[model samples]
Target: DFQTWQLAMYCRKAKLKLTMKSILEEYKCGKVRLVTMLEESDDPVVKTVKPSIKTGRKWKVAEAIDEAKECLRLKEVIGQTQTDRKGLGSSSVKWWSKTEGKEKRDMVIEEVRQREDVRRIQKAVQQPQQGQWTNWDSAMQRSLTWKDIWQMAPLRIRFLIRSVYDLLPSNANLVRWGKKDDPTCPLCHGRQTTEHVLSSCKVALSQGRYTWRHNRVLQELASVISTAKGQSNPPSPSFTIFTTEGGARKWCWRSNTASNQRKGLLDGCDDWEVSADLPEWDEHPEVIRRTTLKPDIVIHSPSTQQVIMVELTVPYESRMEQAHTYKKEKYLDLT
Candidate 1:
């Protein structure tokens, strides 16, 4: 009867049929105890010793022992209570105990203190009036001088003064009546200002192509310097436009007309004046005539001594086709 009961309990717990021989082998291996086996067995001889404890339609003793073992294994692995098992019809105990709660609160407070310290340091670093000439306003005040105001003015101040001169009639007119509302350029009928006249005016842009060319040349020069010396600190190129006899007359004529149009105390003066005269070359003097060039950009190349000349032209499709044909013909002639 004990053997039969053990086989029945084994079948119920394992959810598989257990032969009497397999049950005996497992019992000898000490996997199933004799007492547990006898308690869960359905044999009449075993039931007479202790009536089978049965809650109707609930887990049997064998099934309950198997579940308890599984729960214990899970608890060991995950450090959780068997009663807190999900989908098991059990209530949970609080996982976060008092000690865990205190540790979390301490971490939050430390993070807040760290954030406050960072903000305070940032505020100290960003405090204004901490250094002389640290900002644009202070730099301007420190750079201002009597010589700058009168004769050898800084570039920015000169630009501003020139702008005022171009806008108002004269210094006298400016003193008499702050500044005039007229914003027309005296040299051209375009809008007047340092930025507009020098950078964006159509007439100025046409004349400024030389500036782009000069920039390309400077870039090439820097590249050559870097290659030869194995150093990156190449000096910047100075842009100076020397007027040749051929272009000088034309420039003077234009300047005179512009002066006459303004007809004010500060009208007849040209803003751009260079002390150095144009270089003389008797062989090809007219071919190498001087013109004003402003540099738009500068870059460095890895090869060549003479800077590469890069001309930017927005040519029409027909003009481009003609240029291509001309080049092809020239190559054919050379061949």
Candidate 2:
């Protein structure tokens, strides 16, 4: 049956049975003949249908119609011309025929699809053994439709789709399938989850696999900041200083302006220097300080005496807010 085929398609996609209702609720196509029930008083066919049917059950259309007419009363009423006695199509209907309604329906469908994608992503993240993607954008998943998936090689399509749904033959999944006795990671001696092999292994981290990617991102950001407008060399310090006997020192900035007002942050700074923690490249930025804490990127303005530190993190979406908060607090004193 068509319904069975539809259900099978959803199952193939790893979707739940709840989607069956949505598939069956779309507009039905058949020989149109209706004028007995109107679900809403403001429905498009309200003016064309008989007043008795329109006013019969205004409060709760479905329940009232079910109780009164049983299987006879249609849920959605259709407009019919007096002479032809045929139901009017959507193009001829009033409120339902508006272009805004079509646009709004498309927007709602896209929003629902995005939410479903996010739900699937969160489910994958929560899978302890097979979890891999925790920071994927729902928009990217939503953009890949069945048409695109079908175009990929069959083996690739199966592998890619199975990976997303945690159905791949990973160690943990093999254990779940009764094919393996243990799911321990060979290198780290921890549960061999998909994420562990790809990103979270201590041995891999120690070998600088993750750091390589982190530094690559930092290098690009540092390059952008270095070439940004208003980034120039700072002028030489021009000030008068006095040291008291107790070793306390005081300094006054000497400016050409007669206003005697102080300049704001970055007000007179033309040169800004950019630095990053990456040291693998020949033209790598210089280390600004030999402190214990080193940020991913740093932008310093000598003239303004201001410094901006940037810390980059690639955390899971579920822990993104926590990571951001911790980073901000860690750098609060420096700021």
C-alpha TM-scores of all predictions: 0.20, 0.47
Which runs in model 2 stand beyond 4 Å of their true positions? 1-47, 50-169, 227-270, 280-290
- At residue 97, give the lDDT of candidate 1: 31
Show how many residue pairs clash in every candidate, following the order shown: 1, 2
Candidate 1 residue runs with Cα over 4 Å from true position: 1-178, 209-229, 232-335
What does the lDDT come to for candidate 2? 0.51
Q: Let me know the TM-score candidate 2 reaches against the reference structure.
A: 0.47
Error of 1 at 16 (Å): 89
Global fold similarity of model 1 (TM-score): 0.20
lDDT of each: 0.36, 0.51
Candidate 2 contains a number of clashing pairs equal to 2
lDDT of 1 by residue, 1-335 (tens): 23223322232221222222343333322322443445446787885695444433542444534443454444456754452224543655322233243443333333333333344334423433111112222111123334545664467554443332233243333333456655566556665543454344577567765456445554564445334333323332233345777775332222233323423321222231111121221121221233233212222232322222222322222244454465455335325
> What local lDDT does model 2 show for residue 12?
22
